[model samples]
Target chain A: MFEALGLMVFYENMLALNNVSLACGDNQIVGVFGANSAGKSTLMYTLSGIMEDIAKKELMAGGERITLRGSINYKGRDISHDKPSKRAKAGIILCPERRRIFPESSVLENLKIGGYLAKPAQAAETLEYVFKIFPPLTKIVRRLGGFLSGGEQQMLAIGRALMAQPKLLLLDEPLLGLSPAIQYWLAKSIKEIAEERGVAIIVAEQYARPIMPIIDYGYILENGSAVVEGDKDELMNNPDVKSAYFGA
Target chain B: MDILIYGVINSATLALMALGFTLVYGVSRLPNFAHGALYVLAGYICWLLLNRLGLPYILAIALALGLVAVVGGAMYQLILVRIRGMSISEIIASYAIGLAILEGLRWGGLKGGTFTLPAFLEGSVDIAGVSVDFQRILVVVLGALLVGLLYFFVNHTRLGLALKGMAQDERAALTLGIDSDRMAVASMALGSLSAAIAALILLPLGSIVVEAGYHVLIMAVAVCIVGGLGSWTGAILASFVIGFAQILTTAYLGAHFQVVVAILAIILTLILRPSGLFGKQKELEERV
Candidate 1:
């Protein structure tokens, strides 16, 4: 479960997400469609507590607050106030944009660090679980992330996030920079992660068609706000959504 | 044969110092200028415990190392941590602080008083017509063992892997739930601790002086730069190369020019191969 009440975030003097609010029930895949610079990444960063200090002060001043922001609850006990590390322990893991894999480290090393969120003992089981989802990763676990092809690095990044056993997974532009074939494969894997694990997701993306098959709900982020929100069918056919996002 | 044995000792010493330097730079991305302070402090601490306090040799050594570890850790947090997100000024300030500490010890000691190591193992051992001091041999063996242990700790243990990950990408490591500040402190402690060990071996080599850490630290900078900043393998290989170069220079040109030649070598390496002999070029795409 995830909820953002009037969640407003901003970078210095510029509003990114203004009074933006959304909610996702357990295991729901909520796809956020927006043009470039629509604050999708900032929204994900704020939700995951990775919002930098510069943007954090601006967002707090912009009167935007994340209420009950994590998997636990929305009223008060939520991890909105928790540090990034604590939030991760609370199972609010984010697969950041650009993959953000430790480039110099091996694939296994990246996965191992992700496993540190819980405990060392659970690593083997986590590794096995992750490998089941992305078997290609198991073969290249020893290779450095920098050496991995773009598609492979994306897999490793998402797989590393899975190793954390996140209850609420935030995928930021997973399909960005991916080829059509690889994008299809990654979308399938992401759907499986959300469906099989019941891991709630809030993915931010420019391309909506690839994620439309898996996403239960959709929110269209306009200039600085979520101008439209509904079930996939309703929002997919909305005139504004079609023109601004799908270029229909 | 004697020259070769001396070269081995030289290599071992250079490796020991470079290990500490590289460990600090690897994680912090800043060359810890205070590391030399730790080195010089280690010797002074040992001297005070052994000669002034009249403690037994073994006890003194342990106390000195433990003391330096605590002091090093604290100083890193107080001074180094203040400049955590700042620019290269942190490194410059750290070096200044280190120099200040060394000079303070010297000035505090009244006209750079004599510094000497406790006569732990003074005898010499002759091997195949090559006479080497027992202490120097011990330093070589013990240094190798320490470096080996450090290598194992960094490469084998889970905590070590976490630490190496932090060095690789601090933000990503933190996102994985590793407390990066804790890792940094631990890394600094280990780096300073290694400096302490090198100081222990360095005691017999020369008299104790605050300035004693200066040259050794300079040598470490050369070795680390030549090897590569974050590459442990590079640091080790460069240490051997520099160590042999130093010995050859000392034997042929004389001791006074050894330091100059080493400095020249570091500048040349920095110019020729800025990425280091073994280090990868820094990826500029991340900042964008």
Candidate 2:
């Protein structure tokens, strides 16, 4: 299980994420729905400890000042200050937005790279599992990552994340720029992955229609704040949540 | 006969010199201007071990290479890590380090062409009526072997694949538990080892002088620039292109025209194609 409390992130004077908190239990799929600039991706970055890296890089470059204040509890440990790689080694993997696959590497290489922390046996098993789950990837095993289509890239991204044998998978806008058909299909696959792998998943997205059915718990975020939190039925049936997030 | 035989030898030497520089730049995007200094340092260390300590030649070479790897890794971890992501600072800081090392040796009384590593073999052999020295032949053979081994390492091995991922998409690699700093350190060590190996093999052909340090830097820069910066295959091909051009110029125009050819290759590559031959990923995408 994972939990975060009093999570606040600021970029200089502007608040990017304001006291937003959420949690997910083991083998559970939690959804955070919001519009663009709603701090959804920021939350994902913070959870994965990439914000720490970005802030350090920015400070060195004399660029935007980033400040993050939060406590993330993963299992029984507090990992707020852990480096991204450390968090990854602890089995928290982020499938980042826009599918940042290794452009020059092949699909198989990308997956192999993702298994950086896994033992040889674990990596090999996960590699086969990935190709099985995302059957389309098997066809483009030798194709370059940059050459994949949006749907294919999304699959590879998730597949790559899975190669790390994640305990908690953080998916940031996996459905972005994809067709509705693939979005729903991917949403189904996400549920299947969580069920089969028994890994907790925190998926942040703008499209809630397909995502809402699979998420056991959901939080509606607006202007960097989580405005609503409830079970799937309670969130879907809320008049305000329906109007704002679902367009109903 | 001279052109063909010497061209291959010269090309292999260039490849060996540039491989470290290119590999470091490819993985960390850190243009280690200190590459030439490391090359010279390796040769100097081996010479000192052999002469001063009276160590065996093989052991001296191994120790020198190991020391060079440690120095290279320390260079990045101590200095380059701070200025990383700012390419300008990375260049200036690394160049300053390189300058200090190269000049430090000069100030320490390493001068002239008197210091030379003994060749591994005693004589030369004739191939197709052309007499080729054994040392020069070793450079070519080792160069080819190193290139092959490096290619295999980067693609097939776990660490190499991780480094490749870091080279292409660092944050993506980070989320997979491949630390950027660690990868950079590994690259610097490997790059430095390659530099040392080059110095060890090629220095036997002639004396190890301070000027050779600067010359190696120019050759490396020219090769990387002309080859299309981060592309491995491109660097090798560009090395051959520039290498043969240098040989052809030496044979016809004069020996001094060799460096001129390298500089001209850089300028021409920049003017004709701003990105080296394999610079643009979109162009490579067409092949996929």
Candidate 3:
């Protein structure tokens, strides 16, 4: 279980995330849906502790000033001030937007690299599970990550994050630029992963059609704030949610 | 036959010198100007251990290497860590450190040609009617072995895989719990170890003088630039290209032209490819 309260992020005078609070329970899939620039990625980055790293780098380079104010509680522990690597070691893994797979490395090597924090036995077992869950990865294990198709890259990204043995996995726009068929298939896989591995997942996406069916609870983000929050059936039946997200 | 054999030997020597520099730059994108200072420091440490402390050759080499690795790690943690992400500052800070070490050694009377390490095997062997000294043969053998070992280490080991991931994408690696600062320190230590190994093996061929430090740095930079900065395979291949050019220059255009060839190679690579051979040209294009 993880909870983020009153999360606020600012780039200079512009607020990227404003007073947003979200939580995920054990073995649950929480969907955060919004259009472009709705602070979905920003929320994911802040929760994953990557914003701290970005802020540090920017300060060092005398570039933009990024301010983050939030408390990320993971299983009764306050990890707001923890470094990104520490957060990851504490089992909060973020599969970033655009896949961000290691371009030059082979798929197998990319997966191995992701297993940096896992015990040897855990890594080996998870590696097998990853290939089992995403069987397409087994066929192109030797291909360079950059050369893989978008769908394959997304699968590899998810597989790679799973290799890190996350307690709470953050999927940022996992359905972006993906075909509808692949999107539906990936959504199904995500559900299975949560049910089998019992890892809580928070997927942020703009395409809500495929993801909406799988999520137990969901939040609709507009601009930088959460506009609506409810369970699956409540969201599907809401008129505004239907027109905006489902396009029905 | 002489040219062929000598060319390969020179290439291996260049590869050995540039390996550390390339590795550090590749992983952390930090151009460690202190690399040359570390090379000379290793030799000086070995000399001190051998002569003053009365240690055996193997023991002295090991101790010297260990000491340099610690120094390299400290260098990264204390200084390089602060100025990271600022390339100009990183260069200036590292270069200043290098200057202090090299000049400090010179000040401490490391100038003369009196300091020389004995070869592991003090004999020459004939290969295809060409007699090569054991030291040169050892350089080639060890160079190939080091390359193979490095490939295996990077591919099979967890630390090395983390390093590769960091090199490709720092943020992505961080998400997997690979600490960038720790990896940078590890890279610096490994780079320093490679420099020390290079010095231990190559110093046996001639006297160990402070001037050799500057020469090694220049040659390493030239090799890295021509091979493509931060590319291990590029460094090796560029070493062969520049190595044979240096040897041929020495053979035909007098020995003084050896350094000229390296400088010219750097200039030409910069003017022509800019990114050097095998560099991430697409990345540059994307940035531009």
Candidate 4:
């Protein structure tokens, strides 16, 4: 339901995203695997229209001249130049890397704040659903977001994004620094969320082993380019992906 | 007993003055130096409506507040939005707007401490054997009420929660569909409204003079700096600290040392704490 065509992002003279194309169908989990500095975060930002904001801020501050060349068609609307809020309202929400939860706000407050665009009834229902999905959050509902563990923060981040009622959720390194057990468990929960909520999820990660089993389709990014793209099984058996990602 | 009674009133006055400045900074990090100008602007507008236009007091206060809110939002929409990422420019632009408003009023015949708004009530009551005017009592009552109302609004309401989110992290707020520009506009309007409220109650104690505008700005900035910029609780607490200090200074070291006390509070906070009470980012270590 969401497709980005020939996405190219340039920071000053360096190409951050070099003519990469990606698409995800409804209710699908698309994993984009890449090592560090492989343009995964850049692509995620470009998709969520955050790059436009960054570009604007940089230009206003007379910093780097960021160049974005792409057409993102979401649900048949060309939203390449829309603001992040506009994109979010259009059911595109990005759960950013590092889980930038409001440090001072309580966990419940963070979730409620995420429901900014939702109607009161929708927000209430989503709050219930979020707690149901992330059970640990229910116990620590009163704890400050800053005090949460890394795994808890990731759950809160995803739950917070779910509160935004996204049809296409962009997960940027959801399991960056988690233990393997939590990573796999969280990956399973992500798949269930996709299947149950019917929201398409695009997870960009460096560690592919945990998320690989849950994704339907995947892309392997290397140095700002998607060098390999295929279904999950095809990717697991591919020679290049195996060597780089699977360590086979 | 006198110092205690007067100290509470003084702190309330300082809190009322700094609330708007801290709020706008809290939500969007926009240092609205025109906060003082807006306070004077509200009083002057109300004076014009009540006297020049012959409107009722209630209607005049309401209309003045509404107009100030519009001006605040418009200031952001027209000028500040254009210079959004640079802090120095934001301060300069806002302070310049403040100068234009205060000096423009001076240029337009708002001179020499003659203009004053009538108090909502006109009687003094003896409180614990001390004679206290009704307007000063009203300032304290309204100030406390405003703080409670503002706390409820920010914590309970959706827009307020959205604003709080924006204050914590702008980009994270963005992904949740909370538009920074829109929230900033809302913050400016709300902040300006608080400034007008302070003007309505406190301006009656003295006069709606242009000099008071600059004085209010200095006092507000001093309170916010000591309280930690963008931290309202810190602002209120710092107000009490500086407020009592100012009152004590006025009582003991002559009234002329009151302003000196406020300025001294700001410098000392910077030297010692640096981030005020609740301010983040300048501390030795922060939350993980």
Candidate with top DockQ is 4
Worst 10 residues of 2 chain A by lDDT: A97-106
DockQ, all models: 0.43, 0.65, 0.69, 0.83
Clash total of candidate 2: 0
Question: On residues A1-248, what C-alpha lDDT tens digit does candidate 3 reach at each position?
Answer: 79999999999989999999999999999999999999999999999999999999999999999999978899899999999999999899999987889999999999999999999999999999999999999999999987889899999999999999999999999998889999999999999999989899999999999999999999999999999999999999999999987788
iRMSD (1 decimal) for each model: 4.1, 2.6, 2.3, 1.1
Per-residue accuracy of model 4 over A46-143 as CA lDDT, tens digit each: 99999999999999999999999989999888999999999999999999978899888999999999999889999999999999889999999999
lDDT by residue for model 2 (A163-216), tens: 999999999999998999999999999999999999999999999999999999
As for candidate 2, its clashing pairs are: none
Residue A32 miss distance in model 3 (angstroms) = 0.7
Fraction of native Cα contacts reproduced by each candidate: 0.55, 0.83, 0.88, 0.86
Q: Write the per-residue lDDT of candidate 2 for residues B1-288, one digit (tens) a residue.
A: 988999999999999999999999888888999999999999999999999999999999999999999999999999899888999988899889888999999999889988999999879999888899899999999999999999998999999998999988788888888999999999999999999999999999999888888999999999999988977888999999999998898888899898989999999999999789777645543221
**Deviating ranges (above 4 Å) for candidate 1:** A53-75, A78-81, A243-248, B52-55, B110-115, B119-122, B283-288
Report iRMS (Å) of candidate 4.
1.1
TM-score rank, highest first?
Answer: 4, 3, 2, 1
Docking class of 3: medium
Name every residue pair that clashes in candidate 3: none
Predicted structure 1, TM vs. truth? 0.90
Candidate 4 local lDDT, B140-258, one digit each (tens): 99999999999999999999999999998889999898899999999999999999999998998998899888999999999999999999889999999999998898888899999
